[model samples]
Target: MRPQALLPWCLSLALAVPLVGLTPASARAATDYQAEDAVISQGTVATNHTGYTGTGFVDYTNVKGSYVEFSVSASAAGTSALTLRFANGTSTDRPMDLSVNGTVVASAVSFPATADWNTWATRTVDVPLTAGTNKIRATATTADGGPNLDRVSVAAAADTQAPTRPGQPSCSDIGEDGLTLAWGAATDNVGVTAYDLYEHGNKIAEAPGNATGKALTGLAPNTTYDLTVIARDAAGNTSPASLVVDCTTKPSSDTTPPTRPGTLAVSGVTANSADLSWGASTDDRAVTAYDIRSGTTVYQTVTSGTSATLTGLACDSPYTLNVVARDAAGNTSDQSNSVAFTTKACTTDGGVPSSIATLSTGWTIPWGTYWMPDGKTALVTERDDFRVWKVTKDGTRTQVGTVPNAVTTNGEGGLLGVAVDPKWDTNHHVYFMHTAAEGNRVVRMTYDGTTLSDYTVLLKGIKKNRYHNGGRLAFGPDGCLYVSTGEAQTPDLAQDKNSLNGKILRMTTDGKPAPGNPFGNYVYSYGHRNPQGLAFDRNGRLWEAEFGNSSKDELNLIKPGADYGWPTCEGSCNVAGMTNPKATWNVSEASPSGIAIVRNVVYMASLRGERLWRIPINGDNESVGTPTAYYVGTYGRLRTVTKVPGADQLWLSTTNCDNNGGAADGSDKLFRVTID
Candidate 1:
């Protein structure tokens, strides 16, 4: 029996499923929920859900690069919420995020996973739900970046009570002699944490002894004010603010300045404000007020605890701020130090793109491209979410297919490279380098905008490790598939031409070689280091674009029987028969992944450089031009480049999603560039 088969009856998930929910035709996106009422939650009750509905599998095997869409029915369709209660069945303590439909629902930090394979943790993502079978997928994400889903209960729409209305702040009351402020207790299904009290607008005291509560205190007489309370449960959910209470403060001059904060530092800086954050500032009586200074001028003031946001500042400039504390009894402390930062530099370097525009939507992870059969659209491949998108001259893209039973995700599996058949108009076929269960394989598939099928395996036996299968497929001038496979990390395998690793594969359109004398239809040339790009110039000479082993990246001209050194001679060397690079860049400058020869110019995408190096392709073996850098760092890391149909522009793909912390607003992208 499989490991999951030995599990107890209560937590078992069955692989074979009977999905009785909405059909694909009835699928639609959910909108935001209006008029939120009080939310209530209860403690988790252990119920034996052995045979639930819709895609439940107790024997959950590895579904790498694929989404496990639970097709369970909702209680009343719109009365649906999502909860991921799962057991970590593996030793690897990898983390992943959860998503609903196509929208990003949460990050790993928001839903932290555990490596304690024996225990189970449940997380909930309460979003607006639609009627019918809501396809809830447990998406897998990791820092090293691969998809690995363990056991999870995706379809458990159990009948439970509403969690308390959460995320509200506490309140405080002030009276003439002394005030009495009371707030509702922080409530949750698990338990409440604490309550905080606020007076007038300031927190005067705390209740419940924890991070929760509302407080009451003395004040000036005859001043009318409103009071509110909030609650926080143990699971970190806070309740809604309660109804307001009217109060009056007694007259008394509590004119003491709040104690001065000790050391202060400028935390977050943007165009508008410097988020002034510091450690907890103390007070003798109570921290009543704060003063902010710019250089030596009394700039502004605030009454808060430790930190406050200093807003209304200049962009792309330097500024400094100082903060002072005061107590309620009119005692003032010295000003805090270390609040300074340089503002956002929009134009640090002289060379950045002045304008950018969107190209297409629904095309994900687009990494490389080949011109379609009609010469009107280019068939593009992506990094993750591997699907083929057809990019046309008008800047529109349509997702053709995910792959031939291929998953678009995991660390490196996806639709990678697309090669249109030379007789594509008649044959109606295209070859793709994609990830599969058997490993990396070259597949021939039929394509329309929404449908994909008729998969014929062109070449099968490639070793698909988790990383670097070197999947780039292209048709040579001789009308043959000149495929490039990486040695991955097995360097010794690269030196052996007998194996597919580290060699350029030469085969007929259907995985056979052109009638040649080079080893009878197998190895074209040997010695390669992740040869990700293959293209021919107008001169009909084949050039390879490859990143070196942690050193210099090089572009080499392929000779029929030459060795373009891999683990041996990197960058360039003084050796015989081993081809030297015509141009070289340090590893920092070029993780040069993909290149395209357009109008006698080779445009190469730099994943590390975050720029496109336009090298003039003089001929098959020759390339000149001073190499211009375009769109450096505006978009993060660029991966692939494909020439626009009969034009000077090329489409570039950004690679920030492959486990890099890109900006929240901007991560991986597809850029269109026009070379001068």
Candidate 2:
């Protein structure tokens, strides 16, 4: 006979133990409720059982369908191992079924006798359990009923808490047919399983929980959408919805090119540069920029304008040039009629100048100087005085007039930048960027040879601070005005596209944003800390110089719609999504203010470093060579450097009267330096 089979009834009585609610130390971690402690029907706690844990086991009546139900608690909803301890005195095997909650997990499970009622055995099965409390029962299946039943043990399989809500979603790469969405990851008690994307209250896409971004396709052009995300766990528990985001698709792709440029012509040919103009091109999507080419090579790319200056050519050399127009969608037009011209013979020695000549002296903070159409007289703006003066080539200074409504508070804010209109002979209009009672503004005034009048406000709403009141203005080769601004001591303003502060703005003479600006705004390039220098290279590429905050200064190449990281990055850093500077300088060495490009070389005037920097331009004007400093600590606080029209000379101004330089009265001066 099997050892589990019954021996005799007398042996069962001898092995009976007294009933007691005692739990074993071995089952301390798992919940072990005594079988007798459970809800029983047609069963009773009997001392006839030996070798059973937790009080006396439950003995069912000798009839089918008798059961003992126990309440089990699970910390999480997952698979749990259930162990049943029992013994049978009869020789026959008793069959039972296990039910968890309301569902039966195992039917007709065999419980064989273990060498009489004194012997015990365990039957284990894994069953699914819900979180919180649950019911598990063992019911007899045969007429002999089930064997003696002991405690029910339940342990949690894993944690069941849902993941934390995901962060706000952002959209990028918004093409006409697709978009890329990204968000921060969510945290969970166990682990996140997946992320579900919802659009307009309906599920649209999914990503791995570890992924923070998703790319979607098949989107309609010029459409807007409301999107969100949710995180889930392995247990199917979902987190709260993430913040909603509104995204709009770009307009349809513009495959049509602009009409071929016409009437190309060259004039004002210098020894190393030539001025070229062409008739305007027509386009369905508006022209953005034009490329002036020599044969198949691009010589210069200027903003949507008719004229550009090609510099750095051999003296008296003949060259063929053509013009091609391009739209914002990267469509290029056919080349215009070619024009051939020879450069003028060199008038100066073909080498950079090593000496500077003092043209004028005794000025108090000369901020800007622009050469007049006659090329002999220049207009200068005094920062603190709010005065416009006409300085002759021989150091004759005459006050033209003070701009009306101009105000100066902090030492930095006052009359700043000045620009002469390209059609100055006919319009006689000159523009100025200055501080006023309201804010910083750009205004145009009439210059009638002797005096200034007819002031008109062109642009306004540029915030100003004691420092970082960037006020630099220049007319690009495209005939549009380019203005540089500062962040006004507000770090976040540099990254804000809608703010006028901390940006390089491209606008028409009347102050409207130039057509085809990256974002329908006056902002051309943003994310500047305190940019004060704006210059276009021989190839019409824009370059900027910015004063750094105690760390490093920067010289950057400006690109439309590109972000130059401020507050996040101070110098060259391997940061994603931010444009890096072309060159960097220690703050003490170069607080570069104004920059000018001549013959493929960039000249930057320094304030704190008290020097000038010459950086040679490389291929396509995309990069710069090593920077060489000149006159370090000799000239005090050089402020502005402007190219002398039709000459190899540049006019450099001094700012020794301002707070930083701390020079005596009449110490500031303007010097002319001839550079090759």
Candidate 3:
């Protein structure tokens, strides 16, 4: 019956084991199932199948009167969980209620649809779990009569104990290197503790019972050994020793030099010896000089620009030369493809600047850069971490003022995009986009170059999604402040002009939208995903760069009352009413964030692609230019791009550390761009 019902009795045996069809168990479990907590989407699932399989399932047999309860506890108490393929369905999509301890913790009426299972799909249910058995009851409810508990299947609790070591025998092979081993953990009422490792079945090392990870290190290189570990529990009950795992250490570091290049050929040959050279390579990440042999005698070793000449040999006298590439680490690549050829005179290419030079002084997360009326002090937005910086022409950086209660340090939630008050030197005003306690807000910081004073809260309460708040504050030539916002994953908000989410709001120095916005002059434009990077040229045209998760990044020129489709469309909108991007980037090469117009070109900063691009514009809301690849691999990430006062230099910020996984030590740097 019930396939032997794989199970064990916890502390509370609740002996009332009801038969499958004995009672009408619908009244007590249906109505009480609040869809608030049953959505446990973050647990581990079995990944052994070619596609996806589940070690976890929902049970609906224990339902009563519009409510469902768990046999013991909720899903969180689980130490190990079942993982399904991302293409699989959602927890609630199958009509399930997650329960633990006769209480419904999480329930879902509708499963949120998504392709990526990492970000939006992990819904934490509200129910709590105890230290015993757990069950998730999935039941349905009918308004008129009844038909909800149709598909009911119960999943037996998972067994975390390690299987017994099958057929223990004798292993005598041993090596110099340290040993590598692995084993399964013991099952438990809750979870197992550390695992005790053994050599020759004797206690050696103790590893954590966490199954998702492994441990192997310390010993002689190139050695072999047998190892095994026993899963131990906090309660002192140990599982059988797992089967022995055999492993070997790595071989000695490869350091042999490559063979010499042979078979030199003549191509584009001339009377004068053609320049001869071999390809360059690095060994162990180090590059050593190349050894060249002319005839039977040995030639000098060249560090760079492979290929040496044959001098003092009779004109056109056949000669054999070999080229070998070596590295500083004493490791060399295979000899390059052999080439037989004559000597060629070398020529020089003229005049490349030692390297492009730009002034990066006074730059600290300068999302927005502009010159005060006097053109002496450059006002750049310092973001929330650095606020506003008042720097003189000589590169003196000073803080304007900080917005109190700022600093989100979470995904795109923090102080971002900044703009100078159209009349900065005259009116002493500055504006910024920051996350307040409530939500994303656009505020103004008032200051006089020397002593900054007072912060004015202009706009607040805009919808804030962790990763996409669309922060790019700019002041149009009309002297109106523009704040771009994100949709917060709520698709409907993008089309709702009245809602601040997914919109570009044009407001006065204070928080009120400009007097003449599209909707009663309150909302500037609607329908945007996450629009960052905004700028207006001398011609008074606004352009913005936006980030799309899987699609192309866009360089959009904002038009009043126009909709840059968000949830409805990504790029190249074939939809009836949607705006298209002026230019689309692959996101890898250009997640364009901050933009600055200079010398009739739009210099936009790329986030994922740490480079600055100068797109030439023709005043037609479009641009063309050869994107200059800079800091190429030098800086891990780039965020905001802007132009300096002289009009020839550009500025951008690196966001490696800001996004986590980045080194905290000076990994984030401000780069200066000078256009030659």
Candidate 4:
């Protein structure tokens, strides 16, 4: 049986789901109940597959009678659409019986293959529902069990409110043939479903609710047209028409091509995606779009922004990218300068994480974990409280001592990273990075097996903010101390080589700059936003993971004097001097924290993403493999992960008591994960 099979039954989640993509005739307000949050029999909640919504999905065992049941509520009893979003990777169809209340409403419902586990498809059925609450259950009829169940959305309540009026219509990129129309998004009680564009009271085009901009094409040249927009709700209620914009198209008979886009740059080149940006091109009419070419083939076409991200590229492969601008007359410009780049190598072990058991519990915001030289015990730090505890391998925890003079920033501050000196057996020195009244500081203390004493300040000068106080410390294989510092929410500090903030600092045991330093200062590598994870691979090469602002989070390979773009670049960009990340993930997928390497695999702990990521380091010792997430949404707010010395196992800790975690004190726990 899978380790997760032993977890307690999942409780029903009560949440509202927006009604989207529905036509007015069939629109109904809906609520989504995650499969993982429903009652399961002979199944487990899993995150191994991508595209599962609301944390995870219920993975059923290949046995008859496997089922997941959800409790749903409706305002009134009536016929409603029950949408089941699922994925089946196998070629064989998995048929299931859907039961409402206690009666089977749909029998032998076929769930066809969706290509792969990553691909999702939804099946909708009109079912009779009672007022108030109803129990909906789906059971596998054959030994193949049911398809991987994502969630079930019940559309019951009627949405009657119309969407608010859209913002006044505006025109841009006007040309002789066509122009671009844009307006602000309209608000709806349930959700806006679509928008209709009208020209002189006749509807000409339609766009999805999520879109605020539409490209108007196939219009007559040299003409004046008045355009307006109307927002529509799922129930077919249309908002008041937006104010009209009078746009005059340019004269016809023009065939001038646009100038080539300038200075094509790429950065944040990951295994599958690269960021591309170039100077805008000018045209006699209007530049309609920029076609990004991979060699001779157009990889992507950008219509609005000067930047475009190229995705779906192969790992560890070379690619030459150039941009060509196009005018309204279909005339194309010359190709821009070619920028040749190689995507980062991605490797994977395909290991699935099974919960062995919770090793320790009742701890609050356990921030850092580091094994002792003896390999039988480890020291842990609590972020909010300046306390240190020595935890044995068998789960015995003893509060050793608290670091004095440590102050809390009240958010993401207080006692943070803890690292035992590699020569601790002889020197008995242990180090800590914490927030102090002055700023963030690195301090050294003497640990004599059972207790901690002799506190001494090693280094200071790293600025601290209410947030972004980077506080992770480790001793590199070269016997030098490596510290990861945050930018203190100051983006400029990351690009400033002279500032210690937003940098990976390398220092001696006494806190002076390490020998052969990059800038003759403590700064080893500049340009980091909020670097938290720092671990050395088996090849003695450093790897770091940090949080991204709004778009992407990054996992980068650290090098001496390498500049990692911060405010200037989020994920992958084509900046000239900035180094790109080896892997990039959506911020919703990886607000990463501490990382540890075991058997050449870097295990990263995510905070907001709430998962443990395993990324394999290739034999080349430089590029990383495809990153896979494990225990996603199963554990809340993973804070730190550390390799158990001399073992193929890792110790993971959680910070459920943090502000974002929102759990009560003593709600956190420590877990042990074995890599197979």
Candidate 5:
């Protein structure tokens, strides 16, 4: 006989007879059945279990293919909630497959372990059931078999609510051939399952409910499209359509390609990179991108521009770069004249010192360091203290004077970037970049070896932000002062040629634009994110180190009027009209701050990376070799590194007093480093 037939007569009589004035069994709520009351196919009844309602519970065999079956009755063919009570005394979970009638409803239903064997828990799942009597079976999936079987209950589930309407749709990444549309997520009473994308009234695409966007391709150029989105739930109910978004693709009318770019020229060749430029090309529509090709491979694609920096080349290697123009319709023009160039040969032996000697301690957030004409005395500027110090090789330091009219409102702004005049003995002029009440400015002061006076403001229009006030000052090979400025976190300013921010500015000692500036303005190079390091190689090539946002940190070779591709290309991207970095490091390894060239080697100081990177400069300063790290994590945070004049040593400053470093105030130090 079945296990149901073994139930006690007294309990069966109580279930058959309803209470006085109560409804009959057919009209009553759903019923629950204990595991032992059902047909136990392969399990033993355990009466020692506590917290169970029935006389006993089933403990299934710990072998493969163990199961318990329940005969259930439902009023109609619809959704029903199936709740199973069980206990897992073992440390591992026991999973089972649930089947209703003959169809599998849920797979791998987990029966997690409780506190003890006496503890019980319920796992409810929504399953479809047919009218009349049906069989519900729980079969073990693993050899360990199912958990201790307690009881199984069934209840009807009726869902009618639809998902909430999707948020307004927006379009982006619009191109001649494709575009992307995105919207906010929609919520549903039940779980959402999928979404449908509509173009006009017809459905064009479908996405998972969790997906918030979709990309549509194979689009006609110069065409406009109306797009909307609808969210669907697991029950087949869909929400109202999202707000329509209009997207227009780039136009493609004229098949005529741009005229072949001419006058290809290569400059600033380094060990691993070169700067290439050519005359602008003309097209019937408009030249959209220029493909810089090396042999058959496209080196870089620039947008609507005629120049780009070719990076990541091999040292002492020859390359032939050709320019090709393309229009909106993707028509390519004839290749321009090819230019051949060779990278410089490596100079250093590619080794870095494993140890450093302390020079001075207790400095506060030193931002810039420069060697004086005397070759033994060095000058250091503190970003937060707005003070300058004159230090000797033996670690003796003196407070020369405070920068006049300097103010510090943000963490990055204040007195920064100090440069000694190349003709310091005669002129005694020292230039500085500092923050004032108005903005960040450059000023010249007179230093007579002991004291500083005669402060004169030369240039003052560069925008300043709480952070990213790129204040690195140096005298270029042309004997003019070079200033690096940040975009003040304003992205568009990086692309604006007229903005002083997001550029490397070159000017005379009196603060006027340098005579050979490319744009007739102070701007030397534009599109810098937050460049802080500037060093000139033996070949007069200027190398810059910049802090990148999340993606990459860059080491750029500066060129006149060149765009370094800040907001457009973070590192080495294929975008057109922007110059790529010669070398890039992950942000964690190289938040590169200060750079110096010593013995034909580029030494970069990292703040967050807390290391010094040494890059070997090749012959003619054409390229650079692989970089090796030193003093990693041994030092707190390195801020600046400058070559000592007429010596084989470099001055390294620490910036542990600022917010990120977390070092105690007055705990920073200055080190004299010797690279072998």
Candidate 6:
């Protein structure tokens, strides 16, 4: 039977049917199976929301294919009513596929909102079941995942049989900290769910039900261990332990680091790329990797060979680099003698500066600028004062409103990044990213061409710090909102896919994870240190600008779900699974903040470089041409650069009033730069 929502009718039916299903004639005794007691995948038992039955409800992760399976039994083959209690707080419907015994009975079953998460409701569906054990599964069909599931009520029995003891386990490929453990599979009446490996009575590792082997790691070096395996079924039944196997880890004897690399030489130097080769280092056991360093910080790691290629280098730049050797034991050798080289000069495209005219003045650290759909006015955000202004194409400015609950980090965080919805003419919606009391947030506000109102938070929980609080937003050609976030000064967070910080997020206007996202979350790309600039080229491809740690700043062509290799690579690298930048500048030459595209050329504004970098997008749309600097040292700390909607010009803002500039309040000015 198709599922139907139960609200008032379910409450009355539950009170009136207390004794209705107590006999076999009435389809056996009705039993309530709590979702937390069932086998859950890609979900968690959560008590964050109230009004749930039993201990807690299953909070499914925001991803498709997440499910909760309940093993149930029946007295005979017959049709039974399955009543599932859930809570959906979102306005959008969360749909799931309901299956019985691995066969789908209902596809895309709608679970509508129950006002709020605390409010509970029910949906009943009738399905045929086998006399033996049957599995009832609800799998999410949308990226938003299933709603909070409380329990499933039906007349069914529970499985209680345990699996047989696992066969004797054997060890192989033993190492200093890990080993491979294999065992014979165990049988169960209902089927085994997993096999857990134990060491000294403590569970250490687990393998899937169909597997008889697992790799165990994190063991002590040169230590002997007594390990056994125990099989478990879906009903939480555990079998007797298998025969124990004793093993010893390899000794940690290698202590010497690899010899320093020899004869580091640079050859084939181009404007944007270089090739280097070095003598291989020797180690006591094995030299695992080689690190290429610029000054002191390592720029890239070479895992297999002594020759490497470095791309994305700035034109006409001088570089001093060294090499270090590393062994498998994590020991590092001293730096090799440095090699200094100067890249070839750039061939200028149509990127030469024509004229720069002051458009607006008396502003304080204008951090972001986005044009309105009408192309006659633009929205501008002040980083320190949290003020948003409306500016005309003719340089007329008006104080529209201030973002609420915006707190300053006293450094780079305050009110940053303003994006107008593509449908702003109809929705009057505008989005902003700012620092708050707890963290950073993306909020939506309403503007009716006169004032801003109706402040509402769309997304939050991005950590913020005094520095590295990357706040940049733009609307993609697909009508999705894109946000750039920093790692909050925590370098490791950049590499973590689960963290919202140090990520480029793509979401809907409602702040939901955009459809077709790679990780089934809001993260579009990860491993970014402080990505502050986001722009779309003529081909709708995304281009980004990021601040490097100490060595290089980067310009990247963004791709969904690609890893940019933060905390590991600074600029170009030879690492696998990590994307290299299209162009890179020395940290002193470009602490790029905001970027804009005009006529297939990307204009990057630099804070520390005090210059505007113009790089032409190659015809292939994958790489950038040689970069040329404009207005060097003329503008004090350039901050934001925005393309004029229908003109070959850019609206550039200065950040001279910021902490880095140390200028007086209202010292910042806005200028219009015409491309030749």
* lDDT score, candidate 2: 0.80
Model number with the top TM-score: 6
| Tens-digit lDDT string for candidate 2 (243-326) | 778899897677798999889988888766788888999998699889887765555578856888775454555688898998
What total of clashing residue pairs does each candidate reach? 51, 4, 52, 12, 14, 0
Which model is ahead, 1 or 3, in terms of lDDT? Answer: 1
Q: Put down candidate 3 lDDT per residue, 463-576, tens digits, no spaces.
A: 554456788877666666788887654445677665777788877665555654666544677778778888877667788888776657787878888888876777767987
Q: What is candidate 4's lDDT per residue for 1-676, written digit by digit as tens?
A: 2122211111111012111121223244688999999999999999998888899999989999999999999766667789999999999999999999989999989999989999999999878888888999999999999999999998864544668879988999988788999999999867788988866433578899999999999986777787778788755566656767889878767668899889999998987679999999999879989988855455567899899877656456578888999876667799999999987765445333444468999899999888888899999999888889999998999999999888875567799999998778988999999988878999999998888899999788677765677889987767778899987755666876767788999877776676666667778898898999999876667899998876789999998999999879999999999999999987766789999988777889998777788787776556876676666567778999998888778899999888667899999999998765
Give TM-scores for every candidate, taking all chains together and pairing residue i with residue i: 0.47, 0.49, 0.48, 0.50, 0.50, 0.52
Q: Model 2 off-target regions past 4 Å? A: 1-350
Tell me how candidate 4 scores on lDDT: 0.82
Tens-digit per-residue lDDT, 72-166, candidate 1: 44444333445554544455543445455555555552334355433456555654345565544444454332222223333323222223533
RMSD of each: 24.9, 30.9, 20.2, 28.5, 29.1, 19.0
Off by over 4 Å in 4: 1-355
Taking all chains together, the TM-score of candidate 6 against the true structure is 0.52
Better of 1 and 6 by TM-score: 6
The residue-level lDDT of candidate 5 at 326 comes to 82
Model 5 ranges with Cα > 4 A deviation: 1-351
